[model samples]
Target: MSSPLKSLHFAVFPLPAQGHMVPMMDIARILAHRGATVTILTTPVNAKRFNSVIERAVEAKLKLQVVELQLRLAEVGLPEGCESLDMLSSTDPWFKLLGAFDMLEEPAEQVLRRLSPVPDCIISDNFIPWTSDVARRLSIPRLIFHGPGCFSILCMHIVTSTSVLDGIESDSELFVLPGLPDPIEVTKLQAFGQSKPNATKPQVSDNSEAKTKEKKGYIERVQEGEKAAHGILVNSFEELEPEYAHELAKAKDKKIWCIGPVSLFNKSDLDIAERGNKAAINEHDCLKWLEGREPGSVVYVCLGTLTHTSLEQIIELGLGLEMTDLPFIWCIRNKTEELERWFSESGFEERVGDRGLIIYGWVPQVLILSHRAIGGFLTHCGWNSTLEAVCAGVPMVTWPHFADQFFNEKFIIQVLKVGVRIGVEIPVVMGGEDTAETLVKKEEVKVAVECLMNGGDEGEERKKRAQELAEMAKTAMKDGGSSIRNTTSMIQDITEQLAINV
Candidate 1:
């Protein structure tokens, strides 16, 4: 009943964001299932949120535990008890979050030094670059946890590091991304939204009071941890982006391991059942509505946690979704006060009645995407959501809002050949941080939706390829798949290092 790999112990520190936490927790689950002693270093408030899940896992006898390391939000000017970035009411907290993240190093190192049975290695989100220093001082190997696939990471690397877009001044100028397996075209607008390797100093901002000069140093050092990490751990299979994975390793000069769709390895059906029982969710209504629909007929919509659009844009989007005349479930993410105004005035709810469902709060995304009724996804192209859609075999209708998302959109359309874009007229600048997205007219939305669901040649081709990808994703987690072998290699690498450290 005991694990032979009990001698291998690991400490995991995930960035306190929903997207980051979910995948990292899955990594912990995989490690613990393999008999490794796992300590998840997190803030007390954030730790408590995930504790119930870990408790259940432990009750099921997985070797995992959550250790709350002190993280004083007040020290960094955030309100008391503001545990996660998503809890904040603001639009741009990138620098503010980094400042708070930097403050955790002292507490984390103290926790690491005193861990009774010292861990063999530390696996951390690359956002928390400071952890690499702690691991080095403590004589342990540290591995970087990347939430996005190799394709997105490598695309960003090339776009930022090289002059891939240096000469272009026009938004329409398209260039092929260097070093990719497929030829992908990007306009000046789309490429400029990415965080360049050497960013020019900002002139000034309306909210400059919230930032300090010290935080600028942290921003510059975002990629510094890669140089110090033992290797990089990515949440993608080689079959999904084999060439990009290889290019990423060569670009960063770090050994790479592809050991995910980690969520596929989740050990808790109880967790899902508990979530399903929540009465306020109205999940049953969605399910009931889906029951009558033909297979792969409905569209699933979610724009992710951080994206905020103008009220005008929301109305436009709602009108656009309505124009499709097909069934849809849109997970709207605006303030509760403003939701009714958008829906009621447009007669949006009344117009579509049982056909269009608007979900305001948390909904089981992974479950919804995999449902038989979900033929297409209208997504913000966040990595976690992108991979989930790919695994679910649902085609994407990508409307990328920020960061790695635009690049991820390319991965789906250009590389995977499983989705279409909303033809966002102009690229929303810098992850939609400084500037607001220009309205994607109702017509653009209607056209993209029509293409994805029309069952025509292009639509059928995309659906076929998406289903094939779904098969590959499932196979990757199977015993003989590349991911399973890669996972073994990661365990052996750490286990070997643990022996040397011993």
Candidate 2:
């Protein structure tokens, strides 16, 4: 050695959602373990969430750093609370996201400029395009991390370039996607029939006509910014989606690395039970509840933070679970008052009694999945949940709600064959002027739960597949394995590129 191979400085910008933040944190941890000086930049809110994980990492001697960037919108004339992606979801989501990037550009630049030794490379979320510009201005290499599956990223590229958004009629299925191996249904798209025709950016003028024009102009600019990014990083393993990842690489003439199942890599850095926001939930109560249960007997149910079901639907689900009579740990957010009220009124708490545990607010999802008692997951098919379930060797009962969840459900049931769909029919409403429709009844729920709990021909097959995928996930994270190799290669590539430019 040449100076014992000095550690490189890498900056990460994660999308402000729990799903995005978790995977990005995993990547940050891996880099830190490999002796890279990592700085994770998040908003004040997300920074607080990151503190627990950072503390855990530091305890393990990972040498990770967390930086909180306060986002101000007044100077940019953008709406308040536009600093993070979560704040912009309801109000002009796309533009607010762009505005967030604009807001971060100066602050990020100042932070990097002030550093004694500049960051060797900047890693950014692909969804936010402003990082590319800042990296260019600083003459630093930018690596764009796609926080979703490779197929999802490919779909985004196709939708943006082919004007698919402009042509999509309400409820019309986009049967043929350009780059995908199989046709993707339009309804399954992330925007969920919301991508308007000629949907452009907001205009500078206060007048309606001028605003429409400005909106279009702004959208065009955002698209161009995304296209000009330096390189792309995907949160997926090549073995899982080889064909899709290859297609993405060829579509964008930039270096693409598939470093994923990031949650698996995180296991080595921190205890599973210690991974969540402690302030949000009672981890001790959750673990104690799981401790009494037999191995591979409980069902873990979570619909993620964004997917909200109606009161009637929640009641239906509760009844279904009750009917199944399975030991369950259901993660319910505080917002589901209707469901909570219904449970109270229906004697649901007494019905399940000691057999069920309802965790209100945030749950330590990774811990729950990894527990010995968790046999199957009743999921909403969020990519992060899917990956975690896979890592934990847990089969699933797919109940997709919205966005790319439908696509993920298809992948899990159709492609992977590691889980069973809850049922094709939508859930029916009961009583109170609610229209009764075809629903996955309590009977079907019972059958699925039984199959998952007690091994049968089909259940055994699914169990075997789930176990195989879990092993694959484990192997991918081991030394010199796909995930580790890809992460190491990415760091080396960035370091080399920086050296060449210098």
Candidate 3:
């Protein structure tokens, strides 16, 4: 990697979702730190949410610009204001959302061309496979950014594409895939057994558009696009998956950069530096609940934005948390009426009282995890939440639901050894098979929580491992850390290319 300070602008395009937005914002910041101006390509609705973050970064003197593509719901045949996948009431419109992503290619390309420096490259989310062609059209290098660890990437590639689990027919039947650093016993439930999964991990069918009618599925197109990319930048570090990092790069024969848990370097962290890794939380009342609790006593429960559970399951989950008798902060982001209906009918709110704090919207996840009261995370095992739990050093009660999350749970339980498996394998979203009978019984949830927070030798050992991982994540982003070195090398490589292009 060359060290020439060539001025190269970057266009960081994120898939229009909270999970995609938050991590890519950090990537923009990382590039800005390397002396490059970055423009975040996103939707108008998402832009409004990002304005505050962008404002904060600019306040901290970072060269960050946000360019919104005109993705309106009605224009794309979606409901009004339903720009993000999470914004939708049900996952049925997910196909429309995928189609909408293709619609933004032209608008995104326009932003890239209109920029003064014309941008050196397009760093896009893996979901937006169309951007690789957009980069080709503009004759610029393109890279796909994955918001997961190296282990999750490996599992995603292997579990879905390989015949590794051919023999396992039952849901709990465990088998190990070939070529991983360690043995991971995955169940048939881990597979995309939930109806027909499209090209990407779980699946979403592409709408009838000539542009996307490649005979191949969306995920296949993404893979092909990535194969032609300059590199794949993952939100991970060498310390976590050192062997897999080298193995994946050698296997793909592409320049892979380990430049994350990128969220660690946000300007928001500077304000909370004195308070540790706490970010700003939407619900301030959760903090008050935590004030009286002991350190490592409260359970932090949240099934990410997209996961949807039936009202029955919500009742069971609420009861399960209540049964654990441990103070908890449960963050649920389903429609307000349903959440209220279930909680009211079940007397869940009255039962828990001050013991459990339920937030109906997105709270400051990282900030909450860094709180003194949070001891365990009941998570869906999405990579962002998974990485956040790792960074916070809290043991996870792994309950994976969708996408590469099952594999992420495998990484947390098998590879990282910092989380415990609760065997709640099905996604909450309705559409698949009848899983009502298999809903994680309250006893199962109770036992899982007990296994994580109970004062047992195994639980204590897991807690110790989680704390060790937290320390490694903390040190890896410091001045001389491996992640820092990789980030510097990545920027240098790009600037070197820009020098040649000119």
TM-score of 3: 0.90
TM-score of predicted model 1?
0.91
Ranking by lDDT: 1, 3, 2
lDDT of all the models against the reference?
0.76, 0.69, 0.75
Query: Across residues 1-502, which tens digit of lDDT does each residue of candidate 1 receive?
Result: 1234335778999987777877888888778877778999988777776666787779878779888866566776677677675666544455555567788898888887888787788999988888888898889999999868998888777876788877776666788887777887776556544323223222112235334455456655656777889999999999999888898999999889998887677534445422312222555666777788889999998887766566777777888888889999887765556767667676778988888877776677776787798999999898989998988899999988656777889899888999998976354433243244456888888989888899599899999999999999999988778888887788788778767877
lDDT of 2 by residue, 232-306 (tens): 777778877788888888887677788878777655323454453442556677788899999988999887765
Runs of candidate 2 with Cα error greater than 4 angstroms are 1-6, 59-61, 73-101, 163-179, 182-222, 268-271, 274-276, 335-339, 423-455
Question: RMSD of each candidate?
Answer: 3.1, 5.0, 3.6
Q: How close is candidate 2 to the true structure, as a TM-score?
A: 0.84
- Higher-scoring candidate on TM-score, 1 or 3: 1
Candidate order by TM-score, decreasing, is 1, 3, 2
Across 474-493, the per-residue lDDT of candidate 3 in tens digits comes to: 78887778888887777778
- Residue-pair clashes per prediction, in order, are 1, 9, 1
Candidate 1 Cα errors over 4 Å, as ranges: 1-6, 170-172, 192-216, 267-285, 425-437
Q: Which pairs of residues have clashing backbones in candidate 3?
A: 198-203
